[model samples]
Target: MKNLGRVTPATALVLESLLSADSVWGLQIVKDTGKKPGTVYPILERLEAAGWVQGEWETSEERKGPRRRYYRLLADARPLARDFVRAQRSKASSAVRPTPAFNEGGWSAV
Candidate 1:
């Protein structure tokens, strides 16, 4: 698998959503992650480029709608994705935690 480089919070959410299903359509991912199309599509693109995921068009004559592009996580990428999600969660929590602030006078709660 190629390097994923940097995964923003939105990208992390997309990866988390992908974990729940065997394969998912683009709109479904947007819905699951509560992210806009602009944000979701780029993350999917990166995952696909990194060999972490595979995407294909859905073709069903019985269904009457536009073709849906679906994505599935690569078997090799699962463990890496799990680790990434955990790390992102930990990083996010730490960012939200209060930290002490230092001033000229003294240290204070933040």
Candidate 2:
């Protein structure tokens, strides 16, 4: 279950942005996810290693500051995310009852 494997909510936001745009910078992803620089960079490294994303230095156009690393998704990851969404919808449609597990309030009977 690659969908469930490593893509936490925060990582999913980064991936979604890459999917929508041609390429995005680290700072943009940081803005989109609202996570600190400390958290976002490590996740980018993991995604790049996993082949879900490819990153490169911004070239040609110069900015006020140093050029940033732009990220884009691999062709494969898009389908995986789509299929994952479909599977979740299918599961939801066929679900029998509400989840029984509980934590803070009280535990459900086994």
TM-scores for every candidate against the unseen true structure: 0.85, 0.67
Tens-digit lDDT track for model 2 on 2-71?
A: 3347456566666666667878899998888788988888888888887777899988575677889998
- Give the runs in model 2 whose Cα sits over 4 Å from its true position: 1-4, 83-110
Q: After superposition, how far is residue 76 of candidate 1 from its true place, in Å?
A: 0.4
Clashing residue pairs found in predicted model 2: none
As a TM-score, model 2 comes out at 0.67
| Candidate 1: regions farther than 4 A off | 98-110
How far residue 92's Cα lies from its native spot in candidate 2, in Å, is: 13
Model 2: how large is the Cα RMSD against the reference? 6.8
The prediction achieving the highest lDDT against the true structure is 1
The alpha-carbon deviation from the true structure for residue 12 of candidate 2, after best TM-score superposition, in angstroms, is: 1.3
lDDT of 1 by residue, 1-110 (tens): 99888888898898998898999999999999999999999899989998999999987878888999999998898888888889899999888967889999798888
Question: Which of the numbered candidates is closest to the native, going by highest TM-score?
Answer: 1
The worst-scoring run of ten residues by lDDT in candidate 2 lies at: 1-10
- Residue 95 in candidate 2, Cα distance off native in Å: 15
